[model samples]
Target: MREVQPVATAHLRRDETGHRRRVRRLPLVAVGALVAATAVALPQFTPDAKAATTLRGYADGRGVKIGAAVGDGPLTSDSGHTAVLDREFNSVTAENAMKWDALEPTRGSFNWAAADRLVAHASAHNQGVRGHTLAWYAQLPSWLKNGNFSASELNTILKGHIGTKVGRYKGKVYAWDVVNEAFSGDGSMRGSLWPTKLGTGYIANALRWAHAADPAANLKRFSDLGLEVSVTELDVRIPLPASSAQQSADYKPASLNPNE
Candidate 1:
């Protein structure tokens, strides 16, 4: 039997305005399902005649890549988790170390210790790095959220944050989730502080700034529950509920024509 510990429901249940939120649970359920599916779908074969090999080895043999999310604590520590990560994955994503709150708790002050550790580990292991995010509405520092800055000030802040983070990891990170979870279930832009203040074009501006920072890195929009799609030349819409059925039904394959 699996031992389940009690989780703090307060933070997960309430939104920024102290309102009861049900949407948060959907992503958790979707993630659980995705994990189970991935475990069952993983190939159980050796790529070569080597004595011991891993999923990364098999993927490398077939010109495919496999990656996993790794927290800074485990990646920086001497433990089995780090050992397995180094051996089994060809890429690593920082679970939280690269987020807005984690990376910049105060204005103009950056914390790269945790993020740098993960990048170094990936580099030493001969793996690529996927910058988890450059723009996210959630988990932002209170200072930024409550700064009451003007539109021009906020634009400068946003661009500065993206340029600093992405520029630091240029060429090191092969891909970046330039913007995350910017849309709702019905394919409309979500009303976060960013859109509330910066307008919907914030997504485009973010991608542009990230590209400017790292022209070599692949800029991507990461949706919840494995609904990632490339936003290199088009605006992609991801549906909510994050289930395979809902995703298939609402996820349009064609990108929206910007001119239209």
Candidate 2:
């Protein structure tokens, strides 16, 4: 097995003195590739071949919650992966196991095997589990995507799916990415089966359905509708072989938001 190199992680927030300070720093382990988002990078603290503070330890000391996008394969198969996960992070988000297609691939026949394993692992480790998503435009089951259901029928199906899936993990999950990437890059609603059939109200409906299933779980990121907002998937991607000047400049925008 290859060793993962540790890099510093910073959570920028204003202190009581109203000055921004480096409250936490962890060793970053680049996990794997991602598509539109950035790669999964798990944090650790292994320096100079000796014992040191872990990512979770450092974050906890500073009153911050550090997390990583974990894959079910690694959680079950790789000891090193789990060791890093259990020690370095206090929260886990399923990379794909909790997606729509993975949960209900054949309309009514739901499969909770992989997702259950993830939740169970988190529970065993006393770590919080962040429900990946309740609604998204991608990774939809073929039955739901290709079926010829009317608007009313699709809305019912959406509500049922959210209720069943969210209800199953009600108290176990702490938060959910209720609706993922609903808008396009150009600031317009993306074309999807839900919007095409049930209209844009599907986003609001999905949020309500998820909340009904688990009112305690935070279904944030809808500040426009008077809901709280959260910043997830923080990354600064630069072109390959970029100069240090270019990379530093790219991160300026992210620094503007203390929450980022």
Candidate 3:
């Protein structure tokens, strides 16, 4: 949820021409799954004097949902930020609260206070909650990262983690970024503990564990294992004090197709 200037695009379900489009910059491989049942976060818009409706309202009219990556601190403490979220977003993503480290700081001990708060807030606001992630290399607890374990031990640990986390909010979550950032920009599998220890097959195992934990969620089919494709963290940055024309010009849409 790094805030960048100018433009941001969420998962676009269909293009302007009414063709169904899916965004996947990389091949649907071992480590990533995009669940399309829920809507991803849209661009955060500021209040405008000439605006006709809220962002959620506009998206609702088009049969789409607009959401925001909500942080617990601002969501709970900042009234204005919460107000905007309530008013403009129909879905909320737990930016950091749902991450592995945030969920479980110490091995065998989990602190779900923050994540629960976010989910409760979303429920109260009639918003869908998108679980940020289940398996990821970064933001890992010290124990999980530093522990010296055999491949079998690590695999067991991973399965247990996924089952526990996803099971906690089985039906509550709209979708889960089950595995994230598993590839580098060049489309090669990124080096991480998972591949180093558990091998690339760990990704498929993680997905299976997650599905077993909560089969009712993430039921969309885009490829094997009922996973979809998404453009996670889409953003555009332009020079400050830029005009609308410049923003439009800079934010050229890419020709994307998950089938490709």
Candidate 4:
């Protein structure tokens, strides 16, 4: 069985004015129902040039110790011997997730070529690629700043943005950040282009739409600069990593183990 992931409830269930607050949060979506869960790789732990030699030595005789998230760029089609490097360490990540100004400077338009190239390269060599994010308070288009629109119009905008992005990669993207950051430490939802107009439902709506766009995509929510976002929508308790230390025991840390 796949392991349950930790939730962000502690951050959401905080005290207010010296009293307990009844802040409710959404749970994780039924990931297994929609798709087989994707396993997240631990971040790179070593950066030494000789780290490879150390690892090689381990593989050669010492032991078979290898990191899960190890990666490098442009090795698939490198003119130099970098292609060989990619073949050796095939896992890589997308970097331009923070550069929204270059991605979608205009409303309803996207420049996915740069990212697509990376995903294509990784897929060609039988590797995995992660979509860094779907939404962030920072790195957003100025057009989205306090934009005026009806709720229906706002939902359409959000749907278009997420659907296009999530659909473009489809199965190529092993995982996706369906909704990046949508809450504050005080258990309040983050006000953004969607929430400001579409309110709380925007979160679930985004997840639902993205799930349909790519059923095989693994859904992940992040906030507070890389912290997992766990919300309890309706009754689904997505166990996200805690955003802070103020949570109750019900929201405990859980492992997201690989599928059996």
Candidate 5:
């Protein structure tokens, strides 16, 4: 008979300042015995004496990928900051270069210089790129928002935008946040222009169009193919007249339940 052994899993929590606060350990209920029974030890080889000492090196040692959100200003003007970013992170996300307004400020004309520079830098450094977003409500040009168009016309416009952007960076970008902030805090879809103009089906159409544009994208599972949503920005607003202690308590680190 094979001996049954317990396997431990850790859940790490991050505080408001992006620091690891605490770790909670949980035991795997199933597959723990099988894992222990089939576990094998391989001969270990020592790493180089003068191994890399940066954050990216540390993450590589532990088989993890670390990334950062960067802006065009530092990438172009600040060499020191750019050096630190390149040396410390294996992946990069453009803070605003790939947004709708930046890509297509005027109708039927596109500018790709700023975003292209970032992509070129990341490629030179052998770092993976994450496209910020494909469709969003804010930061949109005045023309897109104020233009007079029917639902069908808007649908065509949305598809064309997704195809142009995603197709341009098809193989270069590893992941894309196809849609952003689609939901409110109350678990309902936010009242964004997409839903208001094109109805709920617009999200599905957006994902479909993105996939059609870039069939080779490294998306999630099939069910979640083009719905690779991300919480790019998170803000917590505390009411006034609150004490420091109360504010601190309110800012407690969020807990993640890995079992779920």
Candidate 6:
């Protein structure tokens, strides 16, 4: 197992009496990798040691554990392969696999039959779980497609969605995808009606509300809307980014027209 250690240091530009002061230094981790890049020389290793390391890495030991991910819904369950996956992995990740829309298709209606089973199974096996996707622009319910609501109404709706979901799985959730795809790859914040109406603080509010409901929640938000964007001119000149990027959708079944 590779141990992760952090190093912290600071440098003083000038003395306090003069003008400049010392600034804090960020911690750094030093770890060597065998195959960091596609082309790189590997360390000299005897055949015996190489095979041993490979076997040991896959064994349960004192190291960072891996987890399997499967949506807990009517269409999925912890069976044959999932049981093995749950046993092998120590954590799980979800994008829109586990979100408000998928769980609660209708407003104020809760569905826990599927997720609860997985949560219970994880707890029984001592495995960690990741609750994905609380807020985002896509994968929303049909009602939100073109429905126009006031600022206050929007805020209420967004908050309600986050609070109930995060609150329900507070204790068991390892971390959360608070808001996904809310920004461009350039690092600038993404645009959404919630931000325009409720303001930039909506992010802070989401985190706060999530924390209040689930104080122990570990929040992870993403906003890279353009990271893998694709523009289409087939329908009303729908504008987007390059269609060959890492996240392009030119060949997606959910493209312009599903039936097409």
Give the worst 10-residue stretch by lDDT in candidate 4. 8-17
Q: Best candidate, lDDT-wise?
A: 3
Order of candidate numbers by lDDT, starting with the best? 3, 2, 1, 5, 4, 6
Compared with the true structure, all predictions reach lDDT values of 0.61, 0.62, 0.66, 0.49, 0.61, 0.48
Model 1, residue 173: distance off in Å is 0.4
lDDT of 6: 0.48
Q: Given candidate 3, what's the lDDT at residue 185?
A: 55
In angstroms, the error of model 5 at 175 is 0.4
**Tens-digit lDDT track of model 1 for 38-79:** 111222334565613676676667645466766665565548
Tell me model 5's lDDT, rounded to 2 decimals: 0.61
TM-score of each: 0.66, 0.68, 0.72, 0.53, 0.69, 0.57
Which ten-residue region of model 5 has the weakest summed lDDT? Answer: 29-38
lDDT for residue 235 in candidate 1, whole number 0-100: 30
* Tens-place lDDT digits, model 6, residues 1-260: 22332111111122222312212111011100010111212122222433334322343343333444444432153256554454345544332335555577676776666677666666666655555556665566666645687888888888888788777776667555555555544445666766667787776776666666775433322212111111101123445764674354556656467444
Instruction: Give the CA lDDT, 0 to 100, for residue 165 in model 1.
Output: 89
Clashes of each: 0, 1, 0, 17, 0, 5
List candidate 3 stretches off by more than 4 Å. Answer: 1-31, 35-52, 218-229, 235-260
Error of 6 at 106 (Å): 1.3
Q: Choose 1 or 4, whichever is better by lDDT.
A: 1
Ranked by lDDT, the better of candidates 4 and 5 is 5
Alpha-carbon lDDT of model 1: 0.61
Question: Candidate 4, residue 30: CA error in Å?
Answer: 16
